[model samples]
Target: MRWPRHVASLLLTAVLLVGPPILLVRLVGWPSIDSPQVALWQWVRDPLTEQNLILLLVGLAWLLWAFVAYFVTAATATRVWAGVRWLRRLPLPTPWQATATGMAGAAALTIATPTAPTPDASHPGTTTTTGTDHDIVEQADTADGVALSGGWLPYEVAEQVTAAAGLVWLRRRRAYRPTRPHRHSQDAQDLAPLPSTVAAIQAATGSRPPPPVSAPAAGLPPIGFPPTGVGLTGPGALDAARGLLITALLATLRQNTVELVITRRAVDILLGPAAPHLRPGAGLRIVDTAAHATALPADARPSLSHGAEGGRRVLILDEPPRSSLANSGATMVVLTAWPHATTWYVEAGGHTRTSDTANAGPRVCVLDTVATTDLLTVTGHLQPPAPDTPTQPQPQPQVRVPRPTAPHHDTIRPDKRVLVRVLGEPALLVDGAALTVRRTAARQALVFLAVHPDGVDSHLMAEALWPGLPGQRLTGRLYTTLSELRTAARTAGLPIIDRTGDRYRLHPDHVDVDLWYFHRAVDRAAAILADPSTAWQAVVDAYAGDLAAGHAWAWLDPHRESTRRHVLYAYAALAAAAPDPRQALAYLQDGIRVDPYNADLHHRAASILTSLGEHIAAADLTDRYTRRLATAGLTAEGALIRGGT
Candidate 1:
């Protein structure tokens, strides 16, 4: 019952062109034959009169012409329509260009019709005598000859073809026209500039912009800790607290230390983030309520323990133990959300508790979001302690003895062995002997002076080291610390600490600090911009650790973070210019170690590994980094990594 549109169209065309002739033949009483060949022959032989036969033949020819024209028009229209759609998608110089192009395409497809031949000069509208059949036949033959002659096409058709071709040429010329680059000065002139104050205000109020995607090396991970503690009582502090707590737990476990654990959602919050970073053989064991009731150790309360080779086993609890003395015998008990003002508590018996104010034996520490982050950063460098093995007895401590004063006029060269290291703990080695300053304030003063070779006035030093203390008391403390430092320096036979009135600075000639060497390397690398491989290597090597690691002095963070940024930039430049993927990966790895929390570095490393056909390695690296981010409650960023993968 149903037919394709093309098939139906063809049938309708055939019926319109061929139906009338068949009807006329039937009406004229032409004899019918079953066989088509016989019917055709019979019709040809007895189709009645010549006039009828001629009419039939002309109708057939016209039908054939109509069929040919129909197909040709359909084909041409299809091509022109396709071209119009294609042209519409392109960026045209003007809106009217598409219309003009469509018109041109339509015109190009138009077929020109032939013009009638010119009138004959000799027989123009002539009256024919032609009463005879011979004359009439000759006149008919002459008319036929005139009709057969081919003539030139119509003028309009020629014009349309020319116009279509010309339009196409113009369109092509416009499409491929070259454009000139704008001058920098001209570009600057076009843009309106804002006042410095207004710009600064706008920048401060605006949302932080996304990091640029110029290169994989542009973004670096956060290294070390912030100077000020990220407060735990904020809206989003809960997740951060959980992340930090888990990080601390993992750090302790890595050190093969045992501790008591108590938490409800330990599996979801702790194990999830720590899973990827855990070394092989580490395990987490849950202590059920029944086990706690029946299997509690006799001499020692249930305690967190490590498997052989320092594999971690966490004992997650559904609730705090009912017995107050439940974990009294535990080696190290960590109580979460315990109420305390000045001291931590360890459970002993139903009403017996011990305060660990001095942080002695089996220490118990309260957990919170801010505290967790602080502890993780402080204990980041702790490694698993090796198995204990007994040997010889310890030697007695030696008494400090001051060296004889050097002559004032004597030529005293700067001791090359004098080195001040502040990357981790502040340490000073004079003549290859490490000097130990016991007081925390004195140590801090020494570090402050070491960092600022230009020397700091007493007021500024007091302000930085002791922010809220009275001026007189601060002066007393500063003098006392300086005296301690001088005594140590004198014992080492070095004129390391020098004072000029109120200003105190390390004698630069008598000591060389690690930070100074790091800066020098960076400067040298910058100076030799042409070939900086060796100098850059020095820069990387000299940065042994973050500036004043584990110390979060208010004034020290900015300088520390600034140095880290410079080191990252140097590494980024090196990676970008590396000749091969291997060299680039090496540079990137060094950067990653310095700033392991940086997602961009991990993404870049994964991309390079993917390009090198290391699919498994790339997946592993991406997975591990994403897990780390998840631990830190950065699921949005983790999703970005997954999407990229």
Candidate 2:
């Protein structure tokens, strides 16, 4: 709703709250209240004698306003609250319920990457740490990266997801380089993510800042857990403990900073059935007792690997019996909250209270065991069975860009033609070379025109391209940018941008855009009678990358994702219409290259390979899917299956 409407609603609410009492007071002060029937009857017989016609109309109008106000506030509040996450923090789900919820999150929620390399987070090393070694309690924002507790707000979640997803893409560029100690010290700014990734996050969630969801449960930052000892008890306590352990493991997985001291039984009982697949990645130690899991300086502990950093170890406990502390002063984690021993009490809902309910703190992101599994799976800790795989030991599918017979945007003739390419990096091709416009805004204006084929008014163009600028400045900026674009086109010896009256547009006769061609191909493919292979191939070939990739313009995200959907449709249709199983697998494999986390493509490819009697190859395809996820730290949202899924 607009501000004007909100203002009107506010006024209506005020009148609604105050109006009834005033009306009652006015009735009580009626002149004929103390008189007999004759006086009251006389006034009633000629109501105009007591009050003017205008006053009667005014009173009627007030009644109508009150009626309208009641519906307005009630409807808007309900609509607004429906999207808010605060009230949605669902009471912890049961094992069955949690499994369903957690699996759904695995499919929907994107797993975020940490800010920097931890011991085993990215490249395998030892216990986790982001920067300098600081005690968990000492750092206020320890959970800001992994947010084992989900984001407190919707946008916070978006920021975390987008940032991490961006990093995932960026790391691909550096994947070929060997992991060395010095790589950690390289500048972080060189690898910062673009804004388009943030918009992609919005596209994925259907909201740039999707509504905050009430998480099933969460615990405080594992680092910040009370060192003396803390316990989880009451309803959903075990689930909370499971989530807590998962959070701690994930957080410290980078640096080998945390050691788990528990018995064989505790693993299954605490972490659900997903616990068995846990591979002890670098720095993780699961021992039976504290004495064995004790933390010592690398210098003091000769058993430590040569040159390994020391003294930041954290002990995680879940009542593993059979040993004593023996003067071990390291941080202790106890499963059950206690009065004298447990020190801190945590409920399933993530409300933290000391044993006697005296000390309390705000809740953190929490999850049920099912969700915990889903999260760990996304981070590559737990491996779920391949939903549609025949078996998982076959040849790896090559990640290749399929070459098409039809011309792509890259090879098109630029002889006296202006080509705007928004499918990859925003570029203007003149004579087959890029035209570097003087101003960033100038480049943006060209892209803006490319996306909007029909001419736009200066006001719309100004507001979209430079939203918060004052009218005078917006107008000047728009005029300057347009002039610069025109000059660049002219210098390149082509007439490109055209201005008609108060509107601006690209010249239809001289200009062509890849986006325009993509839409045309998609439209042709949509025709019911069309033999679509040629059109489908055109659609696949046309998509070079995301719309205005590397740029973060808020308006570009929907277009990028929309284009992705179109390409996926083309891939599916093309593969379906292929003559043989091998051809279909090839088509599906190409699609997988573009989007490695697409479950449909992987499933389809696996099924095809299986049908062709290449069971090992099919198994390899499924195995590749899991490894790809582990490489980029993504979990494909596969087909929903619940048979010990």
Candidate 3:
């Protein structure tokens, strides 16, 4: 297939070399040499007579012909041999030579046949072209019609055909060959019971605990390295730590053989089983240990309290008969680990077979006992309020109080709702009233409540408002701010506070918060979709506006955009629910207007247009959508959307 032109070139060279030699030898009528000696052969010569001159010329011609024949034969043989070698393995020519050869061939071809039919006319169905330099049309004349033929193939047509066929075949093959299903089987012999050769069996006729349930043995090797990039320590270590805990559970469930590579401190803690005790007046006391082993020393037993004054609860771990208490168990969990060196955990237990293997250390950090315990203790008992006694009623003084023109009350009840507005650059109307709290601290306090929208306690409020002040001052400042915010809320009618000891939180529903509406809209939308036929109208109603529009909250952008997209989808869904084709098309158009680039919108529009008897519009939209996706560099995926056309 390669060097096809070489066949023609070598043939031409052979013809040129061989033509004269054969003609000369025949014309000269040269006598064949019979002499065996080289000297005699060389001495033999042609007679130089005038008549012989003509014969000499003819002889010369024959000689030349013979030489040409020899050259042509040699060239032909060499070409054939070269081609055979090339067929076995080709050596690509240097780039320059390749380019030059292509140029020469193209030039030669151009000179021989200067132009091809750019405008195909031969076979109209088979000949289609895009960019062309010339045009041609073939026609057959008849009374009824003109039949066209001799159309030229576009340059890229062959390539496109081959690629398309390959792609089609690939897809067909994939469809024909579905994914393999999983199969698992175990032989009876492979499920033989474990050998007890080296185990320390007890001599006494004691009932052995039930053999642990058979488990699927771990099929991984052990290494002193990390697991899946999960470190044993850091900010996200809790998940890994949980995995380690789960590993302990798995060990118990799988009845895996385990080994401990714990630190000395952990060994010390495990050596003694500690129990918590409750005392009469002193509350709870934690005691060191209790010994349940029958083989325990008498002196040790007497000193160790079985039951003391405090409420006693004891934990006992009994060693297996003839088995070291430390190692024999269903779950062999390791507690301690060295800070520097890595340790491994292995599981070996199964119904069909047995093997020993270890995986790299858990991608989790060992718990720091001291630090963890201290943190837990410190966060446990934060007192919210101090005990106070009720004051006696004082009703002796009946001073005349000037009533407001609108008849104001002296005190606002705690349970009543009061509006509290925010005063700012844009001026927010919170709880359906204008904000009166002008101080930054007061505004900030209200902002914190609005930001939390759930509830915030007194401690956090104090932290937010008077973070730099001392504890008592901060507490005092928080009380003043709370009083001001409460008064403002009372004037505006909003639920200002719901107290629990000293903590307070906002009542989200009691006030008209923007977030409340947004969430309500989202929930309403979900409810509508839950039953589309009955709730479609409600879903459309809930999309009031962009979330917190004109508000400077960058964090809400993704949520806002997500809501916008859902709104568009809601429109599409409504389009589907329309009672008539006209209404459906209208809704589909509205959806496209909202989300022009959304493929689903375009698809829905196209489908609606098609149903409404608008073929051109439907086809145009479909084509536009396909082109849009193709321009975005998703041609393969676009082809799929085009139904593999």
| Highest-scoring model, lDDT | 2
Q: Candidate 2 at residue 199, lDDT?
A: 31
Give the range of the ten consecutive residues with the poorest summed lDDT in model 1.
144-153
Q: Please provide, for model 2 over 1-645, each residue's C-alpha lDDT reduced to its tens digit, 9 standing for 90 to 100.
A: 599998997887777777764764576432223456765576678867645354455556567766876787798898889867666875766899989988988976776767874432211112223333210111123322222222211223334444444434433322212111121122222233223223333333322222222222233223445444455565545654565555455544333444434434456666655566555543345665544555344334332335434323445566532334422444455555444455455555555566665756434334555445544532335544454544322212222111122233433445536788888888887767787776767777887787666777998787656432346657877787898888887756667877799987787667778777776666555654557688778878878887787776544533454456567767877888899878888887887776666666667778777777787877777777667766664444435111111
lDDT to native, each model: 0.46, 0.54, 0.36
| lDDT against true structure, model 1 | 0.46
lDDT computed for candidate 2: 0.54
Q: Which structure is stronger by TM-score: 1 or 2?
A: 2
- Give the residue spans of candidate 3 off by over 4 A: 1-490, 493-505, 514-531, 589-597, 613-645
lDDT for model 3, please. 0.36
Rank by TM-score, highest first.
2, 1, 3
Residues 1-645, model 3: lDDT tens digits = 758898998777766676555555576555454554753444455345465467557657667766777776797799999999988797778999999999999888877563653322221122212222111111112111112111111112212222222232222221221111111111222112111100001000011111122222142212112211111222322222322322222222122221112222332343221101111111111222212222332223221234222111111221111222322111222222222322233221100111122322222212222222211111121111223412211111221111112112222223334433321232334433466665445655655564344465788667544322235656767777777767766655555555667766655335434333333443444444354643434434555555444432212222334444545656766676678877877876776664445555665567667667788878887777667545532232442233212
* Runs with alpha carbons beyond 4 Å of true place in candidate 1: 1-414, 633-645
RMSD per model, one decimal: 41.6, 19.5, 37.9
Residue 402, model 3: Cα distance from true site in angstroms: 48
RMSD of 1: 41.6
lDDT of 2 at 243: 51
Residue 610 of model 1 has an lDDT of: 81
